[model samples]
Target: MVKSVPAWLRILSVVFVALTALILLAPLIVVVGVSVSESQFIAFPPNGLSLRWYSQVLSSNAYLGAGWISIQIALMVTGFATLIGGAAAIAIHRRQLPFSDVLATVFLSPLVLPTIIYAIGMLMFWSSAFGPVSPVTLALSHTIIALPYVVRTTLAVLAESNPYLEEAARTMGANRLQRLWFVVVPQCIPGLAAGAFFAFNISFDEAVLSLFLRGPTLTTLPVQIYGQLEFSPDPSVAAVSTIMIALTIVLIFVIDRMLGLTKFASA
Candidate 1:
């Protein structure tokens, strides 16, 4: 039988959990605090509270344009990553194809590689092959990075699901396409939802690829914020960061609602 925790040990455990929560939440709290600061500069434990920075961000053309661009690219990445990764995960789960392990690794290899390395490669490859970088290049690069997340999440969900599902479908006169559409896809829904959110998060926050592949007319929200931070940052940056954080939190809730957090925690 498992031993019961002593009272003092339990107290320490509570303290540890509280500390961990604080550590994880402190940075976001700081960002939100700074975003509401009345001061022009980014100062945590802000002097006073105001929404002036948020208003400034809303009124800024560059920020608005960059946000729109980021949204477009993230949506495209989500679509492409979900379709490709879902199909690839389905294929891998079957293990019908020869060298399935090798193929699985190939599909997930992008996740193992550093984003900076791929960013540089994509920039060089695109510049040399295509005339100049554009939103499409960024979208493709983001999709490449996001695809692995989708594949891994979908595969994780598939791995935990009933292995006999497809066979049962076959026994019920379901062909490959019907079995895939009905049983396999349904089982992977939780993983797909989690992975899609991750894809959108990555594409929205990605700066390395966006920076290197940035064209004269294309700028993502993260890239815009990076430029401002490198040159002249203010509470406006904090406001934008806070907005992104809010979006991420919303997606997290949505994912949790669609599929319990425990289901995709591994993913």
Candidate 2:
């Protein structure tokens, strides 16, 4: 039988957990509070509760334009990263190719490198080859960074999967494509879904790469917020941040409803 914890220890654990959650959530709470402030200037605990900033954000052309650009790029990056990374994960997991370990490391190397470093390198390369920064360039950069998360998540799910399932399918006269479509793909759905979520979130929220590549016509939502923060500090920035936080929470809720989050968490 497992030993029970002392009452004091349990109470201490509860306090520690509560404190940790507060620390983690404090910034989000502040941003949400600032977004609803009646005062023109940003402040914590809010001068008077109002949603004028959110209304201002909705009316602003710059914010709407930037948000549209972000959505487009994020969708493109999510599609590319999910398809390429899922395929890469499957290949690596099967160990069908030579130097599989090296390949896996190379795929994950982007996660190890600093975002700034990648941003600089991408800027130079894209400028020389394409002659200008565009939405496609930004989407490609986002895909590179987002790829590792997809690969990692897919690999995690594959790790816990039965090694003989594919073989078993083949033994029953299923062809290569049939086994992959009917057997392998089903097992990878959870991981691919989780990875797609991460890819979308990362690409949508990524500021460093967007900053490096942003032109007047190509500014994304994060870069727009940064520009406002640098020049005209206002509660509108906080309002946008609060909106992003809410969207993220909604996305998480949707994902949880579709596939139990515990499966991804366990993986």
Candidate 3:
């Protein structure tokens, strides 16, 4: 039988957990507080709570336009990242492709490489080939960075799956495509959903690549926020950030509902 924890050890565990949660959530709490401040400028203690900044963000055309652009790009990145990353994970897991190890490394290389280096290279290449940056450029660049998250998540689920399931399906007269569709795909659903959430979150919050690829006409929410902070930031910026935080929280809830977040805890 497992031994019960000592009282002191249990107390220590609770304290540690509380501290960890505080560290993780402090910035979000501060941002939410600042967003509600009545002060024209951002204030931490929030000089009298009010929704005026949120109202300002809603009325601002620039924020609305940037938000729309960000949403569109994030949706596109989610699709492309899920498809490409899921496929690459399957190939790597099965060891079907030549140099599966190398292929996995190649797919995950973006996570290791510096974003600024990739951004500079993409800018130069796009400048020479396409002439100017566009939404497509930004979407594709976000996909490149977000792909590794999908691949890693999918691979985690795939690794935990029954290895003999495919062979058993073949024994029951299932063809390659049928086995892949009915068997492999079902096993990957949880991972795919998790990865899609990650892709959307990454794409939406991504600032560095968006900044590097931004043209005169191209402005995402994060890029717009960066510009505001550089010039003159007010509570409106905090409000926008709070909204983004809310979006991320909603996505997290959705992922948990769809895939049981606890299922991936060990992963």
Count of steric clashes across candidates, in order: 0, 0, 0
Encode model 1's per-residue lDDT on 49-117: one tens digit a residue.
899998999999999999999999999999999989999998998899999999999998998999999
Tell me each candidate's TM-score.
0.91, 0.92, 0.90
**Candidate 1 residue runs with Cα over 4 Å from true position:** 1-11, 163-165, 168-175
What CA root-mean-square deviation does each model show from the true structure? 2.2, 2.1, 2.5
- Which candidate, 1 or 2, has the higher lDDT? 2
Q: Predictions ranked by TM-score, top down? A: 2, 1, 3
Candidate 1: C-alpha lDDT: 0.91
lDDT by residue (1-267, candidate 3, tens digit) is 998999999999999999999999999999999999998777898999899999999999999999999999999999999999998899999997789999999999999999999999999999999999999999999999999999999999899999999999999999989999999989999889899999999999999999999988799999999999999998999999999999988987898888777876566
Candidate 1 at residue 133, lDDT? Answer: 89
Better of 1 and 3 by lDDT: 3
lDDT of 2 by residue, 112-164 (tens): 99999999999999899889999989999999999999999999989989989
RMSD of 1: 2.2
Candidate 2, superposed: residue stretches over 4 Å from native: 1-12, 258-267
Any runs in candidate 3 off by more than 4 Å, and if so which?
A: 1-21, 262-266
